[model samples]
Target: MLLVLAATGALRGVLDLRTPLVVTILANLLNIALNLLLVHGFDLGIGGSAAGTAIAQWAAALCLVAVVLRRARAAGSSGRPDVAGVVAAARQGVPLLARTATLRAALLLGTAVAATFGDAPLAAHQIATSLVSFLAFALDAVAIAGQTLTGRTLGAGDAEGTRALTRRMIVWGLGTGVVAAVLLLVLAPFVGGWFTPDATVHDALVPALVVVALVQPISGVVFVLDGVLIGAGDGVYLAWAGLAVLVAYAPLALLAGSLGAGLAWLWAAYGVFQLARLVTLWLRQRGDAWLVLGA
Candidate 1:
């Protein structure tokens, strides 16, 4: 999985976004076909679903690596590995690893808390979160753009250009998010039906979906600023900020669970998590410390 991500990032680093995008789309299509074949044709059930996904991801990674190597060869890039450069890159990635770890931990906490509310709430939580993830992936395109563009501009030492790019990306993120929210709102009542036939889960999910819709704009800002900081090589601050947001979120999630609140309140707690991230990133963006002027 990490290899898949690394290959995708490497492609993106060279501004070859279309390759990864096309590769991912094809991989997803292959994944669906394999899942049907393995699960239904082979009768492997849930394990087959997992296997299909793994196979698709591995295929995607290998395809991407081949493309990258082909490009490298075409560019006449042939040399011994730079051990020192590799070490520096690894060091720079550590804080990002930490940040991602903590953020995932918080997500796990939310899932755990949701489970305490019984099967219906847990199912509803799952549906709502799946939608959130789907929307996030779409919105994250803006963040990816921010990451690529911000790095290029800052690497060129164009401070004003970086700021202008940042502003433009933020606005784009917010606008995309608003459109998503509206669509989600319009679809909330019917979406759960597509996922499950259980009336209890379906009804319980509506408010949760509403909560998810309401948080989209906040999510937009959080994702964009996060990418901007990452592009600026400000991962250390991101690591700490992620920790702080997790700390702030745990209690709220726990409180909602203990109060026997439904899925919506639990999701509201997640909103607080996004809001905390927006606050930290907003503050960081307001300063020039992350504006390192060179590659």
Candidate 2:
């Protein structure tokens, strides 16, 4: 993962969009093939899946490094790894990493809490969360685009371009969310069946799935804003905002259980957290001169 991050950051600094996109797509395809081979053909299970992923990631990292070095050489640059540059990048990235880690940890905690409600509720929560994650991941592509464009615009000191790109990418992200929600709602029955043969699980899952579908568009916007802030090097805000949301998890879980709140309330907590982050980011961005539209 570290190597992949390094390769991506370095390549982003030097390469154009098309090259990296092609490489990323091809590498993901290779990784998927490796996953299938190890898991299905060899019956290596989850460990095999992990090993396949690691190998594919390292392979992609090496390829990206090679491409970057070649380009640097062609440009008559030294093609040497800049330790200072890496350090600077790490300084900016650490806070975002912390925020991401904290949020994921809270999610895991939420999962544990749901599991305490028994197999049916746990299964339902898992199905709903998985569906939500699929939508989030799809929208994240647009967020990444926003991040890349925002960074390049800042680097070029083109404030107008940054604002325009941000708005455009946000729209795209929300659009993806809407599409994911619609598709998931339409296919809920089929998807629920694929997860379990239990009619009870399916019954529990249906309502949660609908809730997830409703939340996707809002979550998508939040993710896009997150990407925008990260690209703007506003990781401190991201970290604090994430921490604040995380603080609500334990209390919320306790209250929900004690108050006999349903699975719907738990799912609603996710939407609340996301919405809070979105509002916080929007407020912060609005006040910051650096992030001001066309500033």
Candidate 3:
């Protein structure tokens, strides 16, 4: 993840879009190949899966390092790696990591709460979550774009530009969410069936899948807002915002009577959390006049 972030930062500073795009494609291809060989050819199972992923990551890191070194050589630079730049990036990243970890833990807690209902509910929740994961992949790309744009804008001392980008992202995000929701609603039953042959699990999962699908876009917006805030170096706010969301989970879960109810409440809470982040980020961006001051 650090290498990817470094590569992105470097690309933003020095390289063209095509270079990073090509590198990302190559890295993903290599990762897929490693996964295939380790999981299928060697039957290494989960351990092989881990090894494959680690190897692929190292390969990408090497590639990124080579790119950085080449850039340095082309510039006739003799100094060490950009320690200060890296440290600044790390400072911003640490809180984002904390926020992510806290959010993930809350998700786990939600799953555990669902499990308390019984095996059927647990299975349904897992299936719904898996579907949500698939939806998130596409949304994640948008979030990454928001992060990159936000960071670049802030770095350039263009607060107005950053605000514009954030608004555009949110608008597009809402539209994307509605479309994804509609598709999920239509496909929920079929998607649910693919997960299991069990009728009870399928029945319980279909509605949950629809709910997740409809709300996925909202979740995507939240994720994008998070990226924007983190890119702006608002780590403290990110941590506090994540903590607020985490705090909401238990009470909401306690109020839920059934697995579906719990999932619904969870999704609603997620949307509220994300909207709150958008509001907070907008306010912070507006209030911080220094952020717009010339470099």
Query: What would the TM-score be for candidate 1 when compared with the true structure?
Result: 0.91
As a whole number from 0 to 100, the lDDT of residue 87 in candidate 1 is: 96
Candidate no. 2 TM-score: 0.86
- Name the best candidate (by lDDT): 1
Candidate 3 has an lDDT of 0.71
Rank order by TM-score, top first? 1, 2, 3
- Deviating ranges (above 4 Å) for candidate 3: 1-5, 12-21, 31-55, 75-79, 257-262, 265-286, 289-294
Candidate 3 lDDT over 43-77, as tens digits, reads 99988888877887777777776887788788898
Residue pairs in collision within model 3: none
Greater-lDDT candidate between 2 and 3: 2
Candidates sorted on lDDT, descending = 1, 2, 3
Model 2 per-residue lDDT tens digits across residues 72-127? 78889897778998798789879988999878887787787787778898988898
Each candidate: what lDDT?
Answer: 0.92, 0.78, 0.71
* Clashes per candidate (backbone, < 3 Å): 0, 0, 0
Total backbone clashes of candidate 1, pairs 3 or more residues apart or in separate chains: 0
Instruction: TM-score each candidate.
Output: 0.91, 0.86, 0.81
Could you tell me the lDDT of residue 142 within candidate 3?
67
Task: For candidate 1, give the lDDT of residue 105.
Answer: 94
